[model samples]
Target: MEMCNEDKSNDDTQELSLRDKFSKLFNELEHCEKEEQKQKIEETNRLMEEMDKEEFKSFIGYWKEMKCVWSLHFGETSLSKSLKKTIIDEEKRREGKNEKLLVELCECYLFLINTISAELMPICIPCLIKVALKKEESEEAQNEVETALMVMSSAGYWEFMEQELYLNEIKEIIQYHQEYHNLKRLAYQSAWQFLINRLFNDNNLEGMIVNELCFVREAARELDELLCCVDWKREIEREEVIALMRWFQTLALYFEFCHLWNEGYAELISIIVKAFRASRDDHREISKQCIHLLRKAAEIEVIKINDLLKGGAVDLIFEEILQSTSNGEILCDCLNFYLMISRKLKRMEDFKTYEPKRKLIKKEIFEKMEKEGYEDIIISLHETFNYLSKEYFIHLPINISDYFVNV
Candidate 1:
């Protein structure tokens, strides 16, 4: 009984010692420079390595409970508000030092999160995101959001972060901050991290992750809006054109991967056709992206390809684009679009049900391409496509083929 009492006393003393040491180290981490903080992290890692499994588990539980570790002493909800208020009210703003404390606090929080086990992420991530989603465009706020996105993008947390709710959070972040380049880039990284894992590993794309949360249809809507709102009559700024080109590439990726096709896709094709007509002569890069997206859209017949035929998209390509541009890239994409059309025409030629599509492609695409002196390219591509179709088994969903019968 005496030995038991002594053992209990020793345990209590060790607990106190750990608490004291952690508190002291936390404070030092909060104040230290970057290199010094790295050293402290090494010390912390060594300390963790020295503990047995049970001791390490107990340490993690205690570490998670500490408010200072999260930099959320006033609570998670109020941390950003308080920091913003401090920046606004402080005389340190005049010296350009107002954000110093916030930066240091973010660094300390990052350090703590990096050191903690990924299993503890549920507790850590929500608080980090609360700070990250700070509506301000301040450098410190950007830093916080970037760090959170980087952590979310990292492979270690992907198993937990791939949940639908978290993916929605990433989408919302992107939807809200379309103007901030760094934020958009990192947010896209997080979103792709979730997508690429599910795509290659599971090979399953059912549920909201693909249909709604994948942002494919949503991106089509946004691109449609961008195309409609741009003043095509005037010379667009170079940066604006470049940004538009990037958006085109992004939407192309969505059309390639996400298979769900809706009315938004038809609208996207119509608007892109219009935008292509306006930009093809002036912006080769944008024209190329538009044609490339059209080719991808053609490959996946999940959507109504009739929309492209009806929109006079083929006429615009043959009449204006081929006549105006000498760019090899633009010509290459144009030829690819023609090749895709030929393949479609070949597939539908034998079926009486697809006679309307056959006539439409013949009139809008093949005749026009032949008129434009692309007869040899068209004939050779068809021969190649015919051989490949016979040799290769292209598996498509039954529903996709059924859906095409009506269009």
Candidate 2:
């Protein structure tokens, strides 16, 4: 037994600890021992053959059992020491042995088995997510979450439809993960990535995925879930864990806008914008999280148009722009979210629907611009109006100085 987990408290997790487990599993693989190694290799070959069988039935049960054992036996520090001793024993038995080659042989066998059979996945993925999240939890949770989320988003449904078997296994992993909130979220993300991988292979599925909006809804919902994890009231540093989760959330932001166009989903997106906004006051780093998500939303055309609208819950955008302007340097963020909003407001109405709303919007935008002392914005708005329509924007800017001059 190798010491895998330093934190004994997480022992209840089925994959126990990860540290010394894989190396030990590799070292102890009888396949490497001259006499026993032959038998184990033969057995592995038989298993591999069976994996390609007309009735590849035993694999599911074997992998399930493997998951059970690995989860329970992994990652205990004490276990790590035991495994280290095993390594020493194995090394001593072959005094003139090449450690690197032995390690490589073990890894190759494990890797081959892991890839050909889905068995290792049930053992590995959840634990992989766990360690990744646990390690990046602090100062970086958001980024970790985003990375995970992006993977899932890219996975989508069509990918799973093709790789149905792997997808099914992933579902099992998801079930195991659901019991733990962190894993549940990650599994959701992973499911999406699995689909994304498939989408690349098939254009029909890709087109269909694009036509439907599952990616959009799931991405926003996931971001909300990840962002909700930040409870600033009780401060603590689990940088490893937080970093992991943050990374996951960052991925979610990418998938939402880059793939699904979350900016089109006004209600949920506003919440994302606002939620990130509330955190800006706590720490500057958190404020960056706010900016990341907002930039994601800003990337879409629909959001850009909607940002200036007063109704359909568009007031939130205005409030966000104003609140952000007051929050601090975040206003100067790379996305220039505030600048986007201001530019939209300053532009004269382009479409018919926009025409009706332009009058009141012009007044409100002018008010905010002057309040912010953004004179360049006035010139830009005037230019925008000229490009769109001489008539639509002609009246709005003439009164810009008057609006500022009077106040």
Candidate 3:
């Protein structure tokens, strides 16, 4: 009987020890959760610092192993899933209570992915995009899209571009939405990054970029809509105008290298001419961008002189020079564009195989220039040349008298 009593006592002791161990573990986990929830930045820093320790294999592995703990804390297993749940819950919360919790949660996720490892971005990005694409168009939805775009903009990983669904969804947002300028701006920036990556970083995607999907065409179409709808006169539209111009400039700058300039040439030249003609003191920055784009296109020979003249670009250029002769930058760009056109004309005239059309083309260019008041261009060029020559005599030793003999 004593032996039986001793056995029962031992069993009771073991069961009590097990209960204490569980209680200690539970408390430790709770403390960790509170610490992480309250001090995400600190916790993230701690995790990153400890990443090279012997215990943690890698940042990604450690985060994956913490899935269960995260599930217990946030009621979702994966960070992506947790983010989606938080967005939904925040939307359901009372208007007053919907504070910045969603933004905080999203920012935390963005920070983690941006700082630690973007290996998980493929999973996280899609979820964020879905939230962004919700048709509700509520304040919550717009916030979600904005946050998602912010996160996407931070990720430099190129694999995200490989996902057609992801790219298509972003393209849709940029194409259709005119209200969310911030979201649209970010989307355009992100798409530009993706294109840069594909063109410069990933060599394997060249064939796909050329044949499978032409982003240039899509970007051009969206730019057309922005130009058509935006009221450039409004102060509120300034940022949007700048964003659109930057996007158009990027396309004009790089599309030639991609051999996709033909896809966007006509539309781009038309828009650039319109922008240049619309230039005023208030819109000087956009005018500069338009001129910069024109210079890029002209330098690359993306559009012929005849094509530019036919598109009314010559008149616009001369007009810009006539209006802004005192503006050194405008004068320089206009002169450079004219010089490029003259060079192209000379090249055509010298082509032995195309000699038959050279005289006709030359006559056409001269008549167009004369019709658009070429005398103004010559006067502007002469004044600019003389002014610059005198101002920078040390750098410019040419004889202005001899240089203007032809004019």
Q: Pick the candidate with the highest lDDT.
A: 3
lDDT over C-alpha atoms for residue 99 of model 3: 41
Error of 1 at 398 (Å): 32
Q: What is the C-alpha RMSD of each candidate to the true structure, in Å?
A: 18.0, 15.9, 18.8
| Candidate 3, 318-373: lDDT as tens digits | 67766644466666666666666666766775678866666666677567667766
What TM-scores do the predictions have? 0.49, 0.42, 0.55
Off by over 4 Å in 2: 1-183, 193-213, 225-230, 236-264, 307-329, 342-354, 357-364, 370-407
lDDT of 1 by residue, 177-281 (tens): 544544544344444443444443333453454554545554555556666766777877543564465466456555665566654556667767777767766
Worst 10 residues of 2 by lDDT: 60-69
What is the Cα-based lDDT of residue 156 in candidate 3? 44
lDDT of 1 at 360: 65
Quote the positional error of residue 364 for candidate 3 in Å: 2.2
**lDDT (Cα atoms) of all candidates against the true structure:** 0.51, 0.42, 0.52
Which ranges of candidate 3 are over 4 A from the true structure?
1-139, 150-193, 203-217, 261-264, 279-281, 324-326, 349-351, 356-358, 372-376, 386-407
Ranking by TM-score: 3, 1, 2
